[model samples]
Target: MENLKDEQQNHHQPVKIDLSGSSFWAKKGLKSLEANGARVDVYWDFRQAKFSNFPEPSSGFYVSLVSQNATILTIGDLKNEALKRTKKNPSATEAALVSKQEHVHGKRVFYTRTAFGGGESRQENEVVIETSLSGPSDPEMWITVDGVPAIRIMNLNWRFRGNEVVTVSDGVSLEIFWDVHDWLFETSGSSSGLFVFKPKAGFESKSLSFNGRYGDGEGEDHDVEDDDSSPKYCHVLYAVKV
Candidate 1:
């Protein structure tokens, strides 16, 4: 887990509870900790968790973050289990997933999933990135969402760094920025591509920042008051060729 930081810029070290290994106490439990002047209760059970290519579990487990007798954040598919163990009702305002970073390794294709929108309208969408860097044909790339091709870049050599706005639902859209210069120009085998996905709205006042040339563009920075009506979320994926 990453460190928790509040809006006041105070950093709180995360408490780690190992749920792995053969130890009998490592499977399920509840932990109480204090952070930023608040009591946080963590309830988790991973005895029958399932995983995929990622290190995080994919299903069959529950990790709930409770505070003030309310569940704020819940992971995995066992929400009901978490509620039962925590003995707390879901918070009126659930925690927002502000940002996520994932590293995926593949040769020419990379896959991931992310949820867009918030509240009742939120929906998960599958993202598939396919690249053709070498062959008789010119280098090209295709980005698909929910098994549908959403964005296609032809002649990737000239368009290696670009941004596109893709529509995910009727009234939901996201801005995608990609930088693959390292994959094309760098001779190092450790080269990887960067892709950023952010919702079209809510991020106007405070957008995700990147360290590369993509950060040098105009309108990347905004100074405005924070709006609770529109929550911000961002997903960053690093595709490493292997």
Candidate 2:
């Protein structure tokens, strides 16, 4: 009886440790993303440009639909690319996170959870954290960015709740605007509709070949017709530097 009581006590005790070293993300500031998944010889060339933190605690992670009926969700961590991999035989609610930093440079932190049966049994939405951060999911442990709570999730379909106020991991902030509509692509002859985030002023969007296509791919180049008279921008390139 005594051994059982002691074991129960130890299991129930809150596990506390210095989060500064553990999977803790930047509370604020700038972030740089290095491409590590590709060949090291060409990593730098294929490196993604640095991006600014949205300045709030948020779950504003990004996802790319790699193929029909499949999506690749990511937290934007670049140092250890494998840190985002989903473990084998993971449960339906598999929660994993990574946190790292260096004195000379800012840190990259992130976490993700895959719930197989959450979305009406037809579709599934993955939750992600795009910044290096650490903390339990408790209301008392609220996170703040620029003195205000961060905008975490931007579900255009009104699926997720509880994270109503967006939160920035460190210095990242995202503006939320969404519209629902239907469209068709002539290339694949597939019809799909989804939401997209348009980065704030001064931030640029680059196209990345998720699965097929290559550098100088069609639509990668941007041009404005002389009659339209709109500002012409450079083509968004998407080739792995590796």
lDDT: which candidate is best?
Answer: 1
Cα deviation at 28, candidate 2, in Å, is 39
| Candidate 1 Cα misplacement greater than 4 A, ranges | 1-26, 29-43, 48-60, 64-93, 118-121, 169-171, 202-209, 213-231
lDDT of 1 by residue, 1-242 (tens): 22343435554433333343443366788778786799988788989899764456667998888887766567667888888777788544334446666777898999998765543345777889999998899999999888888899998999987777777754566777788877888785666788877776623434334543432223343122235454366677788877
User: Model 2 off-target regions past 4 Å?
Assistant: 1-165, 183-189, 198-242
Best by TM-score: 1
lDDT, model 1, position 24 = 34
Query: Across residues 136-179, which tens digit of lDDT does each residue of candidate 2 receive?
Result: 43112122333355444333224211212132343332222211
What TM-score fits each model?
Answer: 0.62, 0.17
